[model samples]
Target: MEQASSNHTLQAEIDALKASLQQTNSQLEEAQYRLEEANDMIEAIRSGEVDALVVKGEDGHQLYTLKSSNLAYRIFVEQMTTGAATLNRQGTILYCNSRFASILELPLEKVAGSVFCDLAVASEISNCNELMNAAWVHSGLKRELNLITSSGKEVPVLLSLQAMQLEEGLFMSVIVTDLTDQKKQQQLLKEKNIALQEAQETARELNANLEQTVRERTKELYSNQERLSRILETMAEGVEIIDTNGHLTYANLMAQKILGITQSETDDHVYIDPKWQAFHVNGSPLPENEHPMAIAMTSGKSVYDFEIGMQAPDRERFYISINAAPIRDEQGTIIGSIGTFTDVTHRRKSIQQKDDFISVASHELRTPIATLKASLQLLGRMKENPDPVMLHRLIDQSNKSLNKVSVLVNDLLDTKKMSEGQLQLNKTCFSVAVLVNDCCQHIRATGNYEITYEGDKDIMVEADMDKIDQVLVNLVNNAVKYAAASKQIKVRVVREGKFAKINVVDGGPGIPQDRLSNLFERYYRVDTKDNHYSGLGLGLYISAEIIQKHGGKIGVESKLGEGSTFWFTIPLA
Candidate 1:
């Protein structure tokens, strides 16, 4: 029993020993947990996420310290490092990044602690303070400088700076950048600016010259247009403008009158032969494909002397001569045509009358005048002295024959003067009474004609005296020549307010009213081809010109069977 009891108690003691050991182990584990907690707290504080930090002297005295920066805390730095670096305001490095140490070709131990200016500053600058202070004051500054490396090599560098507050003092973060490539770029840019300015100035000069050229060309064009306009307006021929569609765009004064319309009342177009309702001179309508102007426009050619008659609806017609040409644009495309027209009606009629007059004049006067001239020449050839009365009678007959010759000669000369517009007058102040007396004396010398004169020598006026005398002589001579059967010829001069008038009265076959309008026209005669007259029909026209030059007027008042009174007026001096 004692042995068994001893074994049980031993077992109990063993058990109790084991339980106590277990308790001791539990306490030890608790203490170890506490130690681990403290280590974790220290690690958390060292991470720089918190403002609190711990630092001490080697002798255990506290030294200068700083709280975590708000920027550093915001960045959540799990690792901390202090490297040799500098930054400009833009965060660009002046010295270098932490990676600079490897490129320095030096032991990293010294490289990490070196100031960036010591390696990268240009050699010309002894101190970096001048550049750094300026950056600090302005917050942003950059300067180029020369610096010497530790090995005595000179380098060009750009020093860019910014201000930073650090543990030691206020410092400007200067960034050192190499300027070798930048110097070359600046030189190239300067050269480019110089070339650009030169090009711009050259362009300005060219623009000024071009402007002057344009102005001069415009002036030349204006002058040409003016000359062309004057020629078109003043030419005796009529000119008209038309578009490609054959519409009249413009016309001169003569054209409007020829077409029988006022300027404003004219239509957009007028046909060359307006009598045709649809088609006239051209294909479908006037100025269509076959028309002269249309052909010129389509072919780019000029056509001259196209005949277009101006006969309206009536048979009473007139002739027109035409010249037409095409107008083209810059690209040589046909735009329109210009047509010039000249009326040839009066010319054609006058030519026909001239032919008839020559034939009639040759037949009528040649027989009578030729016979008289032959007889006179025969009488002169035979040198025979006859009785005074017989010689006087023969002389009188010769004088009559000579007078007939003089009439024919005077008619020829008068026609030549009037047609040439060369009949001149000695226009001067003269006594009209003297001119009248001389004319009267010549009329009295013709014993076959009876004369009557009125008005006295007191009448004075300004006139071409000789021309006025010619006019009076022609009138009186025409009366006697046309009416040798008349009983008497009356000449009279009367004064009206500011003027004087003269009249020559004779009994002769008067003119018809219808022929009176063109009575004074050249080559026109009252007697037709069958009943030929003695004169060339130029006497009356010549008389009219003389009176007109003397600033006088002439006309005839006649009844076909009764008589005619030729009258004239002269302005008083």
Candidate 2:
């Protein structure tokens, strides 16, 4: 029974083992069939044969579907205006659109499988490599670079690269765009800027030239104005310019001096003011309207030799002669007036003196002529039966009259010669003491006064002896005539340093202070109402001239009540 039981157990074990092996073979066949179906499905999907798939899960039955959309994507990329391409991770061109091949001037077959970096210009290959490396980390990379076409031409292009990750490997999608139009526009803009700069430079040069010309012209005008001002200042006559309104517009240096107006005091309106005191030639008060410049302006005519007396601000009077003429414009219309002034005080005085001298000389000549005629008539009467003593007295009277006439003629001749600067002197070394004593002897013989001589006995001087004698005689005669009441005359000579001084003192009513300054002037005399003096008033004048010719000075000292002393000094020998 034990053997039979063991056999059954073995048989059971075999049966079980067979059943397990059959189950393992069935599982292997199902795995093989499923893998074949999976591969076949993949192939069908790629070939566009299968369109749908179904998968069952715990939630429910799920349907998964596949569509041939790559055709649409391929069409879109092929028809794009921009070039499109695909690059492997190694930067090799694996696939490219028709537009990409057209841009590079190459066939699509040739563009694919070519190194993308090799298609770029040699200088831009490094840029392309950098772009490809950036594409691995970044989603998109872009750069502007030049591409080398199949014809060996360099064309500028904009390249865009994008990174795509797939189970096969990492790929880069590249897009290229032509940059020819953009470069042309930039070149045009640069040319326009250069042209603008050139135009600005030309304008600056023109402005500089214009400024230089203006400066030159202004400098020339200033120089001319300065020259005109110098000419006006150097003129001798007092010139004044007035406007039509009688206002002084311009005055030279001489004009300011003549008018007694200082530079600080002169103003535009001062010369035309009517407040100044002015007189006409006839001693009547002159009105403003009658002024030379004013009359010239109003009448439009010249006024010549219009004399007027003007009192300066210091109250000193001046005799002025003016000649004024209207200054006319180019149209002949009076615009202003110009006047010239001359001081004529001395000239007028000289004319008056000549008139007075003529009158006095006529009277003097008449008196001498009357005396001579009386003497001649008496001689004629005595011609019949004249007593000798009476005839001698008449002849003596005639001789005295002739001497008086001869002295008068000589005095007149001396005066004329002195005025003409032709008076000649015969000079010698002479004793001043002798000159004084001789002059006093004549005066003492007249017995009009007690004449005395004092001082050095032998004072010698270098002078015209005859002229000195004449001067001494005149002084003594004057003392006798004027101081006869006092009956005293003194003649003195002294050596003062290098000079010999002579003095003639008289006890006479002293000269008036007002008449002292005029004592030495030609033709001047002390006019007394009583007519106590006679003869021409040329004695003192001639005396002064003679002393001056001898290199001497003559002067007087006197008081109204005290006596008069006339003195002179000459260089001692």
Candidate 3:
């Protein structure tokens, strides 16, 4: 039995030894597996796959970050513009970049230990927690929320949460984007849109009123046109409008009168109508293209002060000064031409008369000057050995020449005085008959003609005696010079009403009827049959002025073959 028990104990011991060996084998296997795991972790750390390791220490759990990942990753996380942070499972901040710390208005060290939810806005704490739970389940989740800063101000942020499972612990990475500037931009855009809508409404209102404004303007334009039409009708100058086709579309009253066209005939009238004869100032034919209106239309330029002559049917030729301008559209295209014309007939006639007077005055002055020069030369030659009769003849010739010059000079002076309205008259009571007789005394002494006085001899008048004598002398002289064929001149004075009428009758060739009207005009002279009259044309004009100054009238009566009578009347005493 001792042997068996010992054997059994040995067998039990063997069994125990087997069990021990099995446990040792299991322990060895586990040691080998752990060794493999450690090697793998070391490999992972070396390869920079593991960032940190969690170790249980005497105090608490601690994180030991591997230096293998080094400064590069830390620099990348810290330099991010978006707030970058790592959080623990309990929402406690483990690592935070400067940007993340700046968002919470806290230092980087302070942010690292702080609970992330504590910084969240009180109203959004639940939402943030929900987002965090969702992020833990889904790995990557995005949410928008507000966080309270260190100063208790709310800051809007967009959070991108990404949960990571590590061998040590569960961690979350958060990317925060600031939304304050973006919200401000959205609000500003909304304001601009509202302003644009208001402006569009104002524009619609202006468009609605545009038609009414246009209608009012049209009415005002019509009223102005009517007023302009009335003004055109009353204007002294002629106004005519021509169409592009060169037909007269409109003509004012003065235009029709000047052009000698009736209103009915205006429809057929053109600027270059054949019936309307146009001439230049020099009496040359004016071509159609040279007309003022034609030039204005063709060249689109104004023609001012263009003097043109036209002869209407059964009317005398007349001059007209034309001012023409082209009518244009808004785009400056020539539409037609408008011309204003003024009748310049009297001005033209005066210019011609002035030219003629210059020629005549020069001729008349030369003759007396030559005669006086010759008489003086003769008197000088006979001075050495003087024959009394020859000397007396020369003296008489000089005196007569001087008297002629004096008369010519006096006439020029009197004409200038009358033109300027500076003629001074000395009035006295004088007998008209006596003045006529005395005026004829010199002619009677010459015995060149027989002078007779008729009518009332005692006719008296209030007049400038010298001026009256001058008028009478001029008439008697003209009778003597012009009526040399008939040697009789009758001077008559008569009283009719409150005036005395004097007449100087002659048997000269009567002036033509056509020339009678202008006889009293300045520089007008009657064309005698002989055309040998030596006096200036100013005699009749001066005589008329003198009689007019005495408040009298002067006129002439003549028949083709019945001689001529010149007469004047002044107020009687």
Candidate 4:
């Protein structure tokens, strides 16, 4: 019995040992399964498949939690105007935003699985791959590349890449910016620069040719002394010869006409005669010693390009550019001097106009460009964490600046067309009243001024409708600008015989009488100390040209203290 009991005890011990072993093995399997589940959860979180993670404590209560940022990141990607995408280490697209798909003109699903390098042009594919490789070492890379769109059109883009290490694998985030508009602007600036260089070269060549011509003519005069009289008579420029004693020896017919001199006065020393009174370019009385002929004779040196205003015998004041050189006889003794005069009143006026145009254009373009630059800089700073309202305001401001730039460009083009006598007119029959009201609507909406209209509602005219509208808008805008304090503007349309008359009347400080006649001149602006007004000063000039082309007229009436009225008359249709 004792042996049997000992055997049973041994068996019971073995069975207990086996049961403990089986329990331990089952616990091990469960632990392994839980570990696998935990790893899967981590992977799901990394892949953005899981949004939240919960941990339970010994009390079966949550101890720690983690939330995914995938939603916020996706929203940010969607909001970006620039294209964004993610690619694998091998340059295969793994993810992409709507903007990226739009740029390629393909569906997002199609783009996500496609090779990024394949989307680039054949010539750019190698470079694209190289750029991707460089991104791994440099952390980021940027390049300009041409991408082939779905339609097979090559589009230029600025591509930027940044390497990212994720739980799943390594990836590269790419940002693509369309370079179409930027390229266009760059091309325009380049063309302008080239044109400017060409113009400068042409001006230099003209000056050189002019100087050479003058030198050649001087040599010819000395070599062919016998034919001097005949040469002087046939020359286009006015020529005169004066002795060293200041007595006039000879004067060509052209010289007589230019100086408004009689046949008898041709023999007199006009330089020393007070009756010939001349003024400096600044309108100061010119001294006899400072005259080109007087200076050349007394100093025995050439005087070139001395511009002065002269009171002709007809009492009319005109500008002349004079060049004089001392003449020497065979013995090398100073004998006399020869002088030539070129009428330069028109040329001086043209130069002044050109200078004014450049000044005005620079000022006009600078303001909008500065505004645009500032807006863009501010927008860039706020892009990462932007307030929706403020972002909208910034965008609106930028749009306004762009519009101003567009308007300035259009005005410049129109001015160029006017200069080339190529300003086209597209005419149509339109009601004058409707046109005037439509033009003023935008200005009136600003609530800065009270606009009043009085006219025959049925008055119709045949003219370039858009051009007329532009003129009307310009007039109203000026009225509002100058009469802001007065706060009132009146527009009137009336029928006078065979013409329809339109007037823009403003209640403001009236223009001076001296400035009235020059109102329609190109680049002419009223002198003002106030900095509120700015423009290229081409509006009135363009308006006048448009009216004249339609066989009409434009004018302004003003009194210093009262008010002003700008009016135009177009032939009735």
Candidate 5:
């Protein structure tokens, strides 16, 4: 019984000890909690969150006011490039800087006291709440989200949240960095990277197939070269290639024909010789250095449409249009020149003829007009005087002037009709010899030369009588006009086979053999250095066309100092 009593007393004493120990532990835990709270307050104060402090001093619970640093804080918040705003735990905006208001496109006063979550896109409202709640627990939290503005424009932004314990309440600080421009730059960079990757892939593929592609390209290149050669050979324009030593390395068929070059004559300098005598379009001498090929080689540049008049070795003057370009090696050194040329002789002559015809037509038309005007004026003045003889003379003069104008207009009209294939013919049976005699009557009346008609006067032919008369008259006139030194003109007609041949012979300075081929071409005239004849150069051309329409042939035979025989053949009736 004594052992039990001792054990019970010991147990009660141990239980009291345990209670005391538990109570002491609870006091220590409370003190620790207060210390943590004090530390938090101290941190808040240090961070300028506390506005005032209460201190227990000698005067007991003295209150002191802290100097305001709101100005500095406000300046820092407003001056920040990123948008800054203060929000409550519920995500209600309490204050916002100018930048924050600008990001939302709203006024600071309007944004304050507004729910910040309203600015977040509808899809991101829940995400914004989550971030805000997390920020309250965690000091710093960040998220990328889209915010909707008053104008319905969605702006991408980086929202950085920081919770602060201020004197007033626990508020969250938000930093909104606009990512619009950054997003655009990132998109652009992504596209460029994709392009670069594609290019790299293509390069790898090309490298892998390089050998086969090269072989195929080489075959195609040869085929193209052969096709090009054939085209160059058949093309109308002349093409020639010269080496660096000024030697003709290659000449197409057209080039050889145009330059009158034989296979053995391969030297380029032959053309630059004094005998060739090249001249510029302006009639100035073209030196060897001035030739298009030479200029292109020397200057290492191209020459375009350089017109030059070159006299062939046969003394035939012709014009050529040349285009030349320097051929360069892989090192960009001019190796030689490749030149193309076209025979522009006919074009050049045609141009000159047109210019001459214009000048001649002006003078011819003006002469008759002036004479007619003067005659009319004189007749007007003599109207009241009534001088019969002067009146008759003036009337004749006016008639002659009008006739000249009529002839010129008719020639132009006839030429135009022939060119348009609109010339109509009225055929009839007529005597060739009779037609010649009648046509020469006017020239015989002039008495400037002796006109003789010796042919089969009864030789009949079916043809347009008026057109035949015109051809005969034209031939006689040409003989009388060109054969100034000669005193005789002869017209002959004869029957050969089924045709009657007519000939008009002249004895004067005859045409050059070189000019006979182009005699009947339109606008072609015999150029005389001493005198310019008064005509449109259409007589021979018209005569040729008329003879052709009558199913006949017309031509001229002439020698330099001898004379000319202009003849035509018409089928018999």
Candidate 6:
């Protein structure tokens, strides 16, 4: 009976174990089905179906993500909690990561659709429409724009504006970051810089006080200052002071005169010394930047006498012998630069005129002396000529040529007197028309060439009779000399409103094209064979000066093959 009861108990125990096993299998099957559903959902979302995966949390009835592997979506969602911004198409506010909204003192909801400009950001893209239009027209562009928040605060943001051809038309993605805190910190630091500046100011004040006391204690200041000030103001040379910033601090009378700048004009003004003062032959700014005497003081390089020239609008080209030295206090620290300059322009001009006179005198004297010598030789060779009349004619021609030489010499002497301010024009009312006819008649008498005249009627002008005669003679002689080989030399005088125009036209070879511009410059001779073979080329220059002195203009017009005309105009009485 005991064995039977034991077997019954064992059977009951086995039956209970089987029931527990079945329950475990059922739970396992349910778990497998749920996992398969989750996998299916993830696959669907990834295969162009949805944006995310949903799952249940560890606690009962709590929801969570079973799997989230979409990095772009993850970043987009995370941006709502971060300061980084994730933008969508059309530049709409897609997502401001939490950190970003915090930077702007705004909520995510308030910032949505705020756009970049709604915030008070002063960015380069204040004109976003123009930029977007350009981008769409061109396809892709990247630029930086400042961001504004709902709180009317501005923040610097680097924006990458991109265009993509999406299935839903054009799309752009803007990635932004806030630099407000950084800028604020920088501003705060910049404000704090006053301490450093004040310290420097204090140091400067202390040094200045110390220098004042030291100079006074030494008892040499009054004497030195008096000497310096007197020398600066009364020195024979001009003087100027330029602060380290290249500002005009002080200018002496001579300096003002040389540069044509008065104290009134240059007071407290930023002065830029002409560039020629700094450049050398090799196109380098002399003494370098640190060598601009004021600069040399800071850099410890010595500067010596420097020569410079400046051209003014008044046609005053001033040449200055310059000396620049560092201006220092008693402590010997460079404060600025003091430059001494003298007006050497007049001196230079005088020297040049002297040189020009010598050159012209020598050149003019050479040919006449040569002709006289040649004539003497020829006359000597013909001393025993068979024809007395022919010999007499030769002597007469030689004498006439000699008379011309003497006249030119006299004219040179007169020019010297005029340059020395001794010659004066005897102003009178004379008829330019009469003078023109006289010149025509004279040219005709001397030369067998056809010389025609126009406007022979008396048209009076205000000029010295001799000066008018001189002008006409020079022009007619030049015409005769140049047109000796031509068929006709025409002199035309016309009365225009308030001025009378005189023209000497020659059908001979016109001036060379290149020689027309410099016809008035002294000693400027054309390289043409005909020009070289003619009388000295002083006629035009002398005529030009005389005409200009009379308030008239002289010019020439000619082409390569066309005949040339020399013309002048004078004011009518």
Evaluated at residue 53, the lDDT of candidate 1 is 38
What's the ranking of the predictions by lDDT, best on top?
A: 3, 4, 5, 2, 1, 6
lDDT of 5 at 534: 72
Expressed as tens digits, the lDDT of each residue in 1-573 for candidate 6 is 899999999999999999999999999999999999977876674443654322223443221221232232323223121144433434455444455565577875566445544453555445675665566556435455566655676667554444544333454444444444445443332343454355334323323332233222222422344323432443345666666787777777767776777788777444455532433323344544633445544653434334445544546345655545555556666566655555555545545655666666676677767777877787788778646886777777778778778866766665556545465777788877667666556557755777677774677888777876777777767766666677687778888778888888888667777678888765455546434533445666777777877888888888766778888888888
TM-score top scorer: 3
lDDT of every model, 2 decimals: 0.60, 0.71, 0.76, 0.74, 0.74, 0.58
Model 5 ranges with Cα > 4 A deviation: 1-235, 243-245, 268-271, 447-450, 485-488, 506-512, 558-563
Which of 3 and 4 is the better model by TM-score?
3
Per-candidate total of colliding backbone pairs: 8, 0, 0, 0, 0, 11
Distance (Å) between predicted and true CA of 276, model 3?
A: 3.5
Q: For residues 334-453, write the lDDT of model 3, one tens digit per residue.
A: 667777777878768867887898888889888988988998898889889998998888888888888888999999999988876889999999877677667768789988789888
lDDT of 5 by residue, 1-573 (tens): 999999999999999999999999999999999999977885565344774333344555433333333332333345344577777666766566676787788876677657888899999999888877777888767789999887889999988777766555576778788776567542433464465355344324323332222222333323344424533543456877676777777777888888787767765444476557889987888988899888988987677667899887876788988767676654566766767677878767766776877888888899999999999999999989979999999999999899889888888889888876788999989887677767767567768788888866788998898998888888878877778888898888888899889888989789878788988988777767986677788889999999998889999888768888999988899
Q: Give the true-structure RMSD of model 3.
A: 38.6
| Candidate with maximal lDDT | 3
Candidate 3 runs further than 4 Å off: 1-227, 328-335, 528-532
lDDT of 4 by residue, 16-62 (tens): 99999999999999999999998788667445466433333345522
Model 1, residue 100: what's the lDDT?
A: 33
Q: What is the lDDT of candidate 5?
A: 0.74
TM-score of each: 0.42, 0.54, 0.58, 0.54, 0.56, 0.40
lDDT of 2 by residue, 252-368 (tens): 788888887766655555444665778886679888889888897788666666888887655567777776766665456676776767676665565667788888788777777
Which residue pairs clash in candidate 3?
none
TM-score of 2: 0.54
Worst 10 residues of 5 by lDDT: 209-218
lDDT of 1 by residue, 80-116 (tens): 1112244333222223332233234454334422444
Error of 2 at 185 (Å): 96
